[model samples]
Target chain A: MAALSIKDLTAIAKKTKESMQISAQGPHTKITVHMGTCGIAAGAQKVMDSFKEVLEIVDKKDVILTYSGCAGLCSNEPMVTIERYGEKPIKYINITPKIAREIMKQHVQKGNPLKEYIIAKGYENIV
Target chain B: MGDSTMSKETKKKEKTQTIPDLNSVPFFGRQILIALRNRGRINPESIDEYIAHDGYQALAKGLTKLKPTDIVEQIKQSSLRGRGGGGFDTGRKWASAAKATGEPKYVICNADEGDPGAYMDRSIIEADPHSVIEGMALCGRAIGSTVGYVYIRAEYPLARKILGHALEQARAYGLLGENILDSDFSFDIFIKQGAGAFVCGESSALRASIEGNVGEPTPKYDHATEKGLWKKPTVLNNVESFANVPPIILKGAQWFSAMGTEHSKGTKVFSLVGKIVNTGLIEVLMGTTLRDIIFEIGGGIPDGKAFKAVQTGGPSGGCIPESLLDMSVDFEELSKAGSMMGSGGMIVMDEDTCMVNVAKYFIEFCNSESCGKCISCRDGSEAMLEILTRISEGKGKEEDITLLEELSNAIKEASLCGLGTSLPNPVLSTLRYFKEEYQEHIVHKRCPAGVCKALITFTVLEKNCTKCGVCFKNCPYEAITWKKKEIAVINQNQCKKCGICYEVCKFKAIERK
Candidate 1:
């Protein structure tokens, strides 16, 4: 392997950082799927696929789908958090693929989150 | 390490899905993630993902501007101590190795985390293996060493695989192999998988295992920094200690020193498990209060169970009662409170947990893990386990408590290695904190928490029974009998007295006598 110069290493690091910043600057809606062990065991995979299919069906351009680890609540598995640009992030627990479709259609599309499935709301104020 | 397959699925999910920016959440404020900064945020397999988070900037700075001794001096200023429970001064160890007159010095990152509940090291390796490698390479530069080894346990398959991949990436990118980053410093690292022996986590035993020996700790008359693997000077550091190095280098030593207490610098990661509402990996500053960790971070004990005690350190460490919950968690304070931080395993217990049984559990662990090289640790711990078992079985005499204390102190003093020297911690700590519980068992033959099977008798309270059948359905031994519209009965002949029915009883139908 060719030796990397100091300039080359610095440039690579700088490029990586710039790319990371680019992703953070958009006004996109972020949906975080909790994919911890409990989440996976409780059918989080199918839930994630449901989200992907829903977004594709709607042709949502600015929705940024993400994944997170366990929130330390194993009992409430398959949790999902949705953060819009200006609204408070809403956390929904014990979700299924059917519930994922409802979350996308009602919350993501029409801005009406189902209050019954919500574990936490107004998380923005805590931050 | 215990559940790497599960974590691997999490990692795989992380790779495909975009990660939420943690800066926007309140969750980041709860943790100080120096070692785990890029864990959930970045993809582990991608070196560029690590670099984007300001990783390896320290190695770049160290190689370009600083001399070998200058880096050592910076570490000394940081006052960073070893995180693998020893609490030795890290910079001093480096200085000793740097000063030692050896032709070829080696650096070893101790990833053999054998503590039962401790997975802090495993999490670091699995989540951010590059950080550990970068830290190792920087240490090699500082100590003027060219070769490094990460002695991880075979049980940590995910960590070993991830670390092996990271090393290959580093070599391909000219960060590990010859002429690293076009500098004069050339270092390479190898992964040595331990056969999952708890004793191999010790420094001498690890070195012996690496050298194809029986993995028994030799007398530590000579430090490994002077004479280690193959009789060469070696710098051995824990996984967390090495992971802390790059951050200290990139952000100045003063920045790293500013977070923790006076003696212990930087954040410490802990595997917080057992009876807590939030049982996960947590990283906090060195001097954070135990109350804050247990209440604020752990979200307190689950199901309204009152917190009884926390077993810190590991099998080698002791239990801290509820009275000392406000005690600051640092190397000195925890040791002063009769528990050394053994690789940061915090096992929380509730009021229902039996203190005597807890001591017995740790004694059994130590007895099984003790290498028979030392007769005192081997035979002495067996004797302690036997006595603890007898006490829990309602067969103990009043003299057994004093005998246990005496045997523990003797084993602690006479044993050679760390396993033997700290073998008495669990028994001694329980004796110091909850001696009354032991007395209750020996004198009254009563197990207060109803954990000891031989001491407790399970009886069904007909008045409290609503024919719910919860206990009958949940009992593993099939000891409970009930028909429709009838109170459940526990057959004395069939009952193993395992306490499953007691735990499962929702209406307080099962009573312990």
Candidate 2:
């Protein structure tokens, strides 16, 4: 019942920046779909299917769909790692249809690494 | 410390893989155990390949004539120990579960392999599900259990899907469900996927996970063999341990125990990795020396780097110094040297590896994965990681190393589960074997291995420069600019010291100090 004001606008702006950071990660061209058992069990298979279908429709079969082992965080399955040219691979967790589409349009089409959905980032720096 | 790298296939540069020669190893082409026999050979998911290699023979044999205790006696004679780190006697685990005072007896395969760098259990579960099923069915018939559960990791999606199909196939073949092998004993197995808690690999916690409880661990000392899985008699054997049963029953105990050392019998699978040229899976006999594995099988360290340490048994294991490279790899001896054979995961480290970085890495792993169940585990690991991080960053004082030792001792002694108790392994081992390296970081403010970015700096040695322009192209930050009158010079402030410039420059114009 409260009126919208500066605090609400500030929060919205903060959330938007966070979302933009996720979408503008890098010039990621290679998409490593974590088709690990945890990913598939958590509907990663479907997400992979949609990405593949989208890529195929857009005539981008050249995009690699490499698979990797579990990322160790089993709670957030169906993880996706996207790497662009000259950038570190950022992993997106709990990926779903709507989110995947947003990632495809905003990041994949443009050259962003998708930072908001990132469960872990800068793996090269950490590991 | 010499290179264990086998001769590379220079002709096939694209492959980048070296094929090994069996004669160079101790037990290269012998197949004694049914579980691991098909490991490196078959395409895991293909049931046809598994069936072609006498896959269900043990189950068939069990269905025909062998009594349950007879199978247990066979294992007893084999003197097999559980491969899940603790060398607990396997036959006795089966026997106690057999004698448990309960009605709904059960058999469980502890497939929750959470040890970092150790995938021995996952490889088997992913490769040979039939072998584990056969082994469990044998145990079920012996203990009069009608149900079995494979508490695997949720991260192991491939193994889960493959094992699901294998169970259905086994039941269809009358090898599972009611009246297995067309005999009076009927057994069934189901899957319980664990939410990756390092402690869930423990028996009691694994049992609770199956019963839909959170994967948190507690020390009830209830003896899982007596009061496990729904307060009934349950036998939980690690994947590698259960995978050994069919072979023991099939080949007899004497033959099984003949290969390994006097105390530790039979072959062991070691996931050989690290700074080596040839890194892969190797199954060597127990008595084989570390030198043989690193050189003969693993093909030694890559890039002519000197061997520094070999971290065995994951975070729970200790680092054996280069002097002990020839030490015999067995259960009790490894423990005596301040390390235990917690599932065989051997990660070889070369000279370029910073000991401080190694300790930091293991500490980070323990800190993040520490369940936060105990105070010592939660805080001790955080403190150790902070100290190691500070030390690696050249901000360490001499007293920090002493504090690290104190924290490791406290966590190892006071923590609840094996994850906490053994979490100090890397810290203690590095402190024991590589104290000088830590001293170098603290006193000299230099990383001997040139790995710690904070401690290392890149400089141009004018005498070594040849004006090759290689370093110019290799610098990621473009910090190298041409010297107005001679070869290019490096901007020390701008240089990240990634070592790529040093590596690419044939004349070694760039130096890491």
Best by TM-score: 1
Kindly report which residue stretches of model 1 are placed more than 4 angstroms away from their true locations once superposed: A18-127, B1-28, B473-478
- Backbone clash total, candidate 2: 15
Instruction: Write candidate 1's Cα lDDT for A17-94 as tens digits.
Output: 654332334534668786654567788889999999998887556676766544434456687878765655677878
True contacts kept of each: 0.22, 0.01
Spell out the clash pairs found in candidate 1. B313-B342
State the lDDT at B266 in candidate 1. 84
* Global Cα RMSD, each model: 7.5, 16.6
Candidate 1: C-alpha RMSD after superposition:
7.5
DockQ for candidate 2, please give it.
0.02
For model 2, the docking class works out as: incorrect
Interface DockQ per candidate: 0.21, 0.02
